[model samples]
Target: MPGIDRVTLTMITDNYVDMLLPDLPNVTRTGLAHHFDPKTECVQGENGIALHVDVRWGRYRYQALFDTGMSHQVLLHNMKVLGLEADEIDHIVLSHGHPDHYGGLEGLLRHRQAPTPVSAHPDAFAPRYLRLASGQVAPYFNYGLTKEAIRDSGGLLVEHTEPLEIGPGLIASGPIPRVEEFEKAPTDLSAPNALLHIRDGKIEPDIVPDDQALVIQVGDDGIVILAGCSHAGIINTIRYAKQITGRDRVVGVFGGFHLGFPGTPRSKTDKTIEALRELNVEVIAPSHCTGMESIMAIGEAFPDQFMLNVTGSKVTLQAGTQPVVDLDVEARQKIGLQ
Candidate 1:
């Protein structure tokens, strides 16, 4: 499959804001130093994910936002520090109904100079919850955006139950098929509620069917998948991408792998890493909910292919090549709209 000339993924907002990798070649750091050290003027990190994907095909350009992080202020702060224009975002793709992924939509829409198209699964608006260790049911709080809110923000809400061609070669996996035995949903999570499911005459864990991923085919570079949380499992996401695109080779994968946190089985990460290596995934830029143990294991195994993906990190994939792009305050100021 022929790939695009280049595709750029900028980590607009992530759980970690990198400030030490200033000398990491093409890697960029912005608006985070201030958060680390109040003395410095920079942005702070948050528990969420948001990315600005810029793809170029010949002379054509396409831009989209993968997720909107958990906080509007954090998203806005990072964008301001990165000199990102909300108006430049042609499409807003939500990974799932998770608050951390879509909570900032209203803020973004309010700031946008024009209404943008927001895409997600129909179940994204369904109430979600996390079953606690104490067996108590608690609502996943702080959800800020609703379908109505999106419409009020001048966003065209496009909900889909199947894969969609969002841009030139960019596609969003609508409902990932869960075929992997080890890749099961977090035992505690349930959309709406477990009780509600039981009352509705059903007994099954919520698989987060709304969980989806963003895909871009880089000419000759294979497929680059941007997974928001990998709640459906990273391996499942990758395989689904290959299945849907009919492109077997995966050049790069970034975003949350959901490998972190207690109660998560080690075999899950181990099996995932084994599968990724088998697939010959050239680059693994894991961040956000990917966890520290998983990151270290992947880094140790992949070595040269492992790259840190935090706030302000920019990865550029082109035909037969991939590189970390730099992002600084100066660079941000110079880049207005376009």
Candidate 2:
């Protein structure tokens, strides 16, 4: 995929809220207020983020709630409930391989009014685990959504083929080469049999090739990157975004952070923050997997720019103007891990 020319980001999801980010203890707002909902407390609340793409690369890209948030992190339930038609929007760019992000794909397939295509890395079905306080356990990384699944779901399965044009300025990550020395999914996660695997002589190493990102060009607004879990290292993904599409003006970020792994080192978190600051991004909305410590350091480094996302948080992007966002207090009560 080539580098995007430009793009903006629009966050869509549930109404619940919480706090893992330590820096913004004062921050009580997150999640988005829906525009399509009834006259309930939702729409009446502040309007969340809506992105405009006058540029080619930064076009239509939306995430529909594909399942109930019962245990799902990012539910496509709202998207399904609205019965929203799958317009000729750009691409269904996913953040990572977690159940919250991939679970929706199943629902999206069942409800689409027209043909839809999804873009992701080849390792979307690899086995992943989380090291909770109790012990190591499985967290949803085994849904088995493969190339075959895409065909079965009634949508086209487009793998991350470099900074390719999903729709004009919207691009996806290809191979995220980690230049930053500190960042790597420290857990014993494995990738699918997709990419090259080799070792010293026997040529044996677990290939985790499913990690990728959604890079949308917001025209004059710069780039809006949506990450899944960032297991492949956020910096590597950003660097790949810059290299693949030849464009690097990251304005904001959205999706799972995967930072607070039980065994993850403090230095890794600090180094990630350092790289993020060096990236000089405009806005940071760390959600899902982004660990608490990671978010705070970022907020400390770039206060006005770094924030958290929950069920009711929303952000809007306009040309030559500051981004507008709203956090719904009532909606915050409704969020939970599905």
Candidate 3:
């Protein structure tokens, strides 16, 4: 259980993008100045989440692309705008079976210079449908992310149900256990009318058993958790990460908290903030499906710790130091734009 010296997370695709956001401690934003060049393109926002993670431990380094966002067009475009090369990615980690999270996988695999390892749960490829509260099940939409599609696109699938290490100090959390009573799946997809999935030639309730997260241990600074939609409940995801890694102090938690969808009670948000406070998380960046109201509330609650994570945003966490925000000039220099 050794920790890494540092980890850098870049948002290749998200639901929002604001070039006006100023940098804060540990966070660097790709602002308007980055696109000053007439030929330089700006990143676009979509209804999905994709993160590029770079890890450094001693003399070794590892890179992982977590979730491919909603579309390859947006994902690749954003990556190009951020100066990230697809060939540099060493691994791909799918957080769940949702199309928004895996939509760009095929395209990304095709763009890679070599076959890439994709770590995910077996159930992620299952045919799934949304079950409405009126007892109606929506049509199944696989979004062309079948196992065959991944392989055909030069991706080597590495399916698992238990935590797997992607690199030094980086662990892909398997299916997280549901421990919080209040943090159940969305109301429309809850038991009795749960999300539908085909299994053994029969349609059954899908609790999204494939939902997972990425846990990074940053030296003694504690663990940083990166997630997709957190359909299993962010609190549950965090607790599970802690349980599996045996690390108590949570350095940061980023990604969709899954609290803004319809039917989610306001009390849930309150409880989530309370739970996070109890954990003393140093930084929290909720994005994508983490509804705006919930995001605002969390930011208000943890003004100093909250980070506005959007497309083109990069968060850097180094061992034995507080996260520092880089100004536009410094950010440009770091990206070699100066």
Candidate 4:
């Protein structure tokens, strides 16, 4: 068999935790210290959006509050609640520049060590816009992200547009290529959005340099793919991850696909859905911007494989181990609407 990647999601932060916790009685947690520190994120049963992706060596965890719709960037508080000290964090990678993705960055910097050499695309900065009906456009980020601000977050900052190995068997999917026709993430991308440009007309910005993903191998037939918002498009991000990790099969996708394009019809999404199915994804743990309708579609496509992700949710994957839990309380509460 070809190479595969394993995946897991520790709901680091978000809303709807209560609805997602009840389904977690069987989740298998191996590395968590059994002392039961309320300061740490220990989810035995309950649901919320404290989502993080743990890879083989250097895993990715969300240290910030990623819900702009809700006013809160208290990532440090949440991190403490989850029991992960910032000083313990050695490496960091960003998904985009959105407030939710970067909101708690300041809190992250409050840790003992600086998150230098944090991986992200130059496009992480720049004004964002939301495409509304009647062709209405509003500032996507009422509060835009500034590069100088991110630089001060922590550690060394290394801006790379190409895929680079960040950890053991882990690869940060860089600026993905817009090769597929399944989904076109309508970004406010343009040459003007270029955060890094040496000469005139040297690079294009519509590619959304801020958009990227993380890939890791977890088990024999598992390739866990984690995305932030997938502003790069799920298919594109996964394809790039595959290219970067050289893994042909994807066992899981646990992150925000940004499938909340309000007017996007289910028919239009079918194309992308088919692509996801083709990838042989065994789990779909979606949260944040992955809209409700889209979740239903994914549930149909994957059935029991579709796991609802929310605040306080937990997904564990071990070699030769079956899923211990899927969705927690919050997820189930929001499943049928209300």
Candidate 5:
């Protein structure tokens, strides 16, 4: 794959940020509410992920949304703050069927009536859940986005169980193969500790067959990997990306690694850090469900390359270049409404 000029990833919606960066160079003490009209609800931080990926190389440019945050309100609100419209997105690729990742589909379609394609794993819509400390398994209320709802939004559902090339050098890992022994879902995550799915009129451990990630080949810079939630272990996800694309150099890995949870064991976190150190990726930006313990461990291991993906952060990556972080904003006056 030829090298791309640059890829800019903007965190449209995420759980946290040390500082609210509505526009770059001018950090704000308050959230977006300070810059935009009060009537227009300000963009909110949430326990979800919605990324705007803009890739540019030579004369070509491609745009995609990795995930739509749990709520349409936050997703849509953040888009407006970023000066982006739903219709402008070239395509949509979902990491899995989790509600927090796919719940905003209906709102996205309502905003952009265009029949843009949405690529996801075949089992993305299967039922899922989270187990409580009391040994009770609560069905994820939001669960998955329905096909009917997607159609209503003029979204073209493209379901696949295998890896696919979505853009010039972008490859979506259809279903990551689990090979790491230490990287497993927590026991309290469920009785069987597996995501549940309904198939053949029966519900069983889900095993999350649909869990995948997007791999971008940036020449010698190796690969830039993005995951919605690495239900399939992050190490496994990275290895699979390399296997499918025949690229061993992993430049960066971002998005949810499923590391941050009460059920997540310290041994596993340590092992993950050990594996990541061996892999020696250039940058590691973990966010959302990537538990604080794991984040701290990874941060300590890769201090120079570690970055926190908070809401309103813009991370830029290019081949043979160190990752750059900045406020995803320009001058407030420039984006101010008349």
Candidate 6:
């Protein structure tokens, strides 16, 4: 359980893109300069989440794609624009069974001729549906993410329900234990009146057991947690990571907190921010399904720790030093593209 020296996370696809955003101490925005080519290449934003994670621990380096965004076009296009190579990714991690999280999987696998390991909870491939308040159940098309499709597209499926090590200092948190009474599944999907899935030919409540997070332990600086859409509350996810890793100090928590989804109570957002504040999370970069209002509220609550994560933005954290934003040149160099 050695810690990593550094870890870099690049947002390949998200719900927002603002090229005018300036670089912060630890956040590099994909500004107009990155699109200086004759064709004026620009990073596209979509209603999905995908992150390129590069971790370095001593002589060992690992690269992973966490979630594949909502479409191959968006995911691949952003990668190209960001100078990240699809073939170089050592693994693929799915946060849940939702389309927005795994939509670009097949396209990414096709792009990489080499078979890659895809880590996820077994429930991620289950047939799921959205249960309306009216009691009608509508099937959710998970964008053709299936066992056959994954296997056909050159993916080596690796399922796990227990915590699994993805790399030197990276841990794939399995099913997060739901302990917080206030942190129920966001009302948008996984709420009791909403989500359902078929199991043994019987429909049952779908809590999105596949929802997980990536925990990166940086030497002394503590752990950085990354999630896709946190169906399992982000607080629960963070607590699970800390409990499992024995790392109480959380450097940051990034990705969709699922607070802004329709029907989700505003109180949940308040509670989430309060819990995060109690944990003393250093950085909070919410994106994707995290509603704008919730994001703004979080920013207001933790102005110093709030980070606006958009497509093509890179957040770099190194041991003993504060997080630094990596410019295009530095990003390319870190991923060995230059």
Using lDDT as the measure, which candidate wins?
3
In order, what is each prediction's RMSD in angstroms? 6.3, 7.8, 4.8, 6.3, 5.8, 5.6
Given candidate 1, what's the lDDT at residue 234? 93
> How far does residue 108 in candidate 2 sit from its true spot (Å)?
1.3
Query: Model 4: residues >4 Å from true position, as ranges?
Result: 1-8, 23-50, 55-72, 131-144, 186-207, 320-338
Question: lDDT (CA) for every model shown?
Answer: 0.78, 0.50, 0.86, 0.57, 0.76, 0.84
Per-residue accuracy of model 4 over 164-280 as CA lDDT, tens digit each: 666645567778887776566443333232222212434333435567777766555456777777767888888777766666666678777767656556765687688887886
lDDT of 6 by residue, 64-100 (tens): 9889998999999889888899889998889998999
Model 3 residue runs over 4 Å out of place are 132-136, 186-194, 321-338
Which whole-number lDDT from 0 to 100 does residue 306 have in model 6?
Answer: 71
Q: What value does the lDDT take at residue 205 in candidate 4?
A: 31
Q: Candidate 5, residues 214-252: lDDT per residue as tens digits?
A: 888886657889989898999999889889888888878
Candidate 4: worst-modelled 10 consecutive residues by lDDT: 63-72
- Candidates 2 and 4 compared: the better one by lDDT is 4
Reference-based TM-score of each model: 0.86, 0.68, 0.92, 0.74, 0.86, 0.91
Q: Is candidate 1 or candidate 4 better by lDDT?
A: 1
- Give the winner by TM-score: 3
Which stretches in model 2 have alpha-carbon errors above 4 Å?
Answer: 1-10, 14-76, 80-90, 126-141, 187-207, 321-338
Q: State candidate 1's TM-score.
A: 0.86
- In candidate 1, what are the lDDT values of residues 1-338, reduced to their tens digit? 45567888889888886565543455555534545775545656899999999999889899999999998899988888777888888999999888789978888998988989999998676655556557677764424657888998889999999999888788999999988888976443343233211214444465677899999988864788999989788999999999999997788899999898557788888999898988888778888888878877777666557776778777676676444332232322222211
Q: Any idea what lDDT model 3 has?
A: 0.86
Mark the regions of model 1 whose C-alpha exceeds 4 Å error after superposition.
Answer: 23-26, 31-40, 140-143, 186-204, 321-338
Per candidate, the number of residue pairs that clash is: 9, 50, 4, 52, 5, 0
Clashing pairs in 1: 2-219, 3-218, 3-219, 3-220, 4-218, 4-219, 28-327, 31-43, 34-42
Better of 3 and 5 by lDDT: 3
What would the per-residue lDDT of candidate 3 be over residues 1-338, giving only the tens digit for each residue?
77999899999999998887667666777886875767778999999999999999889889998899989999999999899999999999999999899999999999887999999999998888886667676678764778899999899999999999987888999999998998866433454446778878877667788999999998874899998999899999999999999999898899999988777789999999999999988888899989988987887777567777889998888887555433334423332334
